[model samples]
Target chain A: MTKHKIRKLPLFTLIFFLLLFMAGVISGEPSRVLEQSRQICLSCIGIG
Target chain B: MELARKWVQIVIGFLTNGYWAFPFTRTIYQGPLKVVCSPGLNCYSCPASTTYCPIGAIQQLIAGIRFNLGLGQYYLGWYVLGCIGVVGGFLGRMVCGWACPFGFVQEIIHKIPGPKFKIPRILRYVKYIILSVMVILLPLLAVNEFDMGDPWFCKYVCPAGTLEAGLPMLVIQPDLRAAIGHLFFNKLAILIFFVVWSIMASRPFCRVACPLGAFYALFSRVRLVRLRLNREKCTDCGACHQVCPMGVKFNESPNDAECITCMACMERACKYGAISLEVGGLPLHSSPLRKTTKS
Candidate 1:
């Protein structure tokens, strides 16, 4: 690709991911992450 | 700018870990804010952590993808990946320099005067491998009898988890000590090893082993906001090389993957002011010495 196109890619990627992120939120992924993280995270603490 | 950067890191450190009532409550903060993702690597399991670590959340989602799909769930952590992509696309590794609590801890540990060593350049690729295998592939593909996969990176590795979550949790609840075994010892050893190594080398973990860093690096070539270098103004004095904590040779490669946008070179090293923080081709902070020179 051209230099200009390459430069524009991150912005495009950002918008795309932002939309994807909103989709994730609508799908209740954040709630799931919240639920998992709210606990003691047994494996993270190295106990599980 | 170094002093200013230090203060910023310290403030962000506290802001991200704002749940100080963990000691009084004897548990992590489980408020509604937990759904939001912090840009840097702050362990959610850390009692004071108010936000989720992007890497950890990604691994958790990926690990459970198969099981979740079986249960007819459709989400695949688009939010987490989007969070990562947004930051990485905008600022590259600047988050490590100015926001990461774990990176601040590493910098603090490295402050103690000691003999320093250079990390092997080849080792820079290791984080990418870890990101691919340990963080993504293993969590997605490695399954148990129940068809559920573990967050392998958190389970077997991740010294940050040991420092931010494992040790603190153990301190908070002594009852957890009973379950401690080889895993705890292994993680402890890893943490201690990184602590000592950080003193010897600047950001050994960030440079070599951080999967999050690896992921952000993908956007290095295209990050919208970053430190820009003017080859015309640069004398190629190799000054940026000497001052750079991450060993980035800014002259040779302006937007190197490992360049954390720390501005060490621009702050104190370069006198000509060839480097400046920029966004969308506009100068945000330009040459301190020669700001008057027309661009």
Candidate 2:
């Protein structure tokens, strides 16, 4: 492994996930999470 | 440094669960911050939780993947996935060590005077199985008549949910108490078991059962912010191993997957200045005070 190679891997992984995060925003996923979270998640609390 | 970590834990715990008015209102936070992914395991349904648990959010999204795909909606939980991946890749299990509200709770419980015990090595694999089976596979595969599935891990398994959401919610809402039956007792029993176990063992949940811990462990090798061991300085004295609450041997394997990057090795254990916390090949915190007191 070269010096640049060590840096390259993490840089690429960060870029990929950052892009994925941006894509998620474009897909309106946060709204869904928000909507579900706003509801008192009965199952999450183990009551359901 | 440990004091700084403790303050970070406390501040983050408060900031993440920052709806401090929950006790008076007896209501859950339904604000805009609910959309943000909590890096820690603070319960989404907790009365004061300003941010949502990534695990619960992901499970809920995954549980509806098939149903959404069927309707051409395409709910891949990309935001949650990206959020987790970025954090894991960057910090590994630092979140577990420093920010996790539940882990903090366990650490506090472990402070109780008792003979501490190491978790069995075989049990470490159980967290991976739980992550794959309960968090992903079950939620994605086990759909009902409506083509929707359950957040199996949070619903059935996570004691964090039981402690943070169940008991507190029950206390807040008296009418909801009537709905509790076998499930509540089952979960309560699980919570009690872990609470007692933690008193004698450090983070048994993180060691053996936390799916998020399992996920982050995968990134331990590649995490940018990580520990580096200067073997030349190490004496193989076993000081780091004895001091590790998570039982990682720093001299032998600095990047051990189970390592939470708690820096106990860097801060308190390595009297020889062998271990250092680094970010992208640059040392950020290193060179601990030499031990005058015995380990």
Candidate 3:
């Protein structure tokens, strides 16, 4: 309704997603996901 | 919510595990797509799965190290946690209600002819315990002689793994039969119990057992997408609660951890239009309470 509330929405969303993206980048999550994703998890199937 | 759940299941089905192909080839489709993560508790070992299970990855990360900092090569699985955090923080437990294939299965089962009843409120705490004990603490604490901790949740629990991966894997590779033992039977029994329980209960696993759902529940309050209630518009009617599969009393606590964000209370049950869906404080869907004329 108000300009303040309207401005807050996109700013908040942008900041939130930016923070999550930064966290992922800082933690090397993409590579880890890439590596882990490739192999079929043997233990998940009760093999271990 | 039901239609959305079905649509999500279909889309995810196509994404993670494509339509059936020739049996002469590998039963499980393995490709570059495996690098992605499915929002729900789909098993990675499932021949159909194109993405990794975050829960399985988290347990593996916890168990990969011996906790001896200098001696062991360690990976904390920051990526898995980050992916989970982003998804959970954005959508909360909506993933459980809509995107989870296993949850879809449970929903279908609950539709069968059976006497239905609500589970005890105390049982809702069980998922948090499972997340802490089976998923996190056990893997971090228990280690073998080689110092590799076991994925207790994956091995001992996780009916998703049993149904999607174990059963399918067994069918694909019959030699895995010899590997089947007490642990397998134990997991199978748990799956059977849950399957039957799901028939009688609306969403027993989502309410009581899923660690992934428990993890997402933590973000329900702060997630960007949220259910907003206008007290002024509410008549204190219990229609929303009656429609809620998770049995959440939204009037009491709109952000209750058990809420799956299914929007049933918002779109379907609330005749008063007290409830609305919002993203980042911006109202996306609003149903304003109608004014009653005085005779």
Candidate 4:
């Protein structure tokens, strides 16, 4: 594709999604939260 | 051209674990591995990464609150920033161009067949925004009275952590699967984004997103290393621009903030030898020329 012809996707879309993801984390209902139960902090040698 | 090719080869070899210098037995014992610099910036987290990454060390420092800088006699924070600045002042983003392991991975991923895309020009500024928010703003805000701030980049975004540190540890310990949570997915998504975007664009993250790159870019103009243009030497042929993978226009200026000083343009297009690595006011050139016309 020609450089000039490349459609400029809206920046807002990217921001909106990022903000939404952050909000989910703050709200404590992360849509795709990974279970942190089993992971150990290598430094601490304790489960995170 | 030959020198440039050799330099590129050396860079690739260093980055790709191409080891052949040692004898057979030592080579096997030492392995074809790059040594991980401890308490240094090399990400110890990457699986294919034989070397420890510096960012990871910084994050670990913050996480552990290891302020005994003198005891270890290793000041990682200062050392990392100093290394970056020294290298950047001399070579600009040559580290990103050649030595960065993550850059290597991104280049490989970008080679995949797909509908590649470039972030809109306006959106290119988002990397700075990310640097502000993720690296500076968040870390500053997260700091407690104890002066400990979360390593926001590692916590929120760094794909290197996920690929190098997270996935490997998870793979080793199957029991950790149950603990997987939203953070993992969040980082995974970021990794996927860069991986997919790289296919169409070259080092999108370094060009636009990397805060570290942004810092080095600021010094590109006056840093000991520079690209000089001879206005009188000739035509405004757009050869340099054509060769720059980052889409920098050379005729307009040589030391643009975006210019990585990869020397691809200088090595390939500058028929006049106008551009040369300069330290202080001296040009590292044997031949001197009289003043020429201005561009």
- Who wins the DockQ comparison? 2
lDDT of 1 at B264: 85
Instruction: Give the better candidate number (1 or 4) by TM-score.
Output: 1
Give the winner by TM-score. Answer: 2
TM-score of chain A of 4: 0.42
Could you give the candidate ranking by DockQ, starting with the highest? 2, 1, 3, 4
What tier of docking accuracy does candidate 4 attain?
incorrect
Two-way lDDT contest, 1 vs 4, winner: 1
The regions of model 2 sitting more than 4 angstroms off are A1-6, B289-295
Q: Is the docking of candidate 1 incorrect, acceptable, medium or high quality?
A: medium
C-alpha DockQ of every model: 0.55, 0.60, 0.37, 0.02
**What local lDDT score does residue B208 receive in model 4, on the 0 to 100 scale?**
71
Position B271, candidate 4: lDDT: 64
Clashing pairs in 2: none
| lDDT string, candidate 2, B1-295, tens digits | 8898899999999999888888889889999999888888888999989998999999999999888889887679899989988998798898899989999999999999988788888899999999999999999899999999999998888999999889999998888988987887888888999999999899999999999999899888778888888776788888889878787887888888989888888887778877888787777778575854333
iRMS of every model, one decimal?
Answer: 2.4, 1.8, 3.6, 17.7
lDDT of each: 0.86, 0.87, 0.78, 0.53
Higher-scoring candidate on TM-score, 3 or 4? 3
C-alpha lDDT (0 to 100) for residue A22 of candidate 2: 86
Backbone clashes for every candidate come to 0, 0, 2, 26
Residue-by-residue lDDT tens digits, candidate 3, A1-48? 333143253345445656765665575656666666566666666764
> How should the candidates be ordered by TM-score, best one leading?
2, 1, 3, 4
Q: What share of the true interface contacts does candidate 1 keep?
A: 0.72
TM-score of 2: 0.95
Model 3 residue pairs with clashes = A29-B79, B16-B50
Please give the TM-score that candidate 4 achieves against the real structure. 0.65
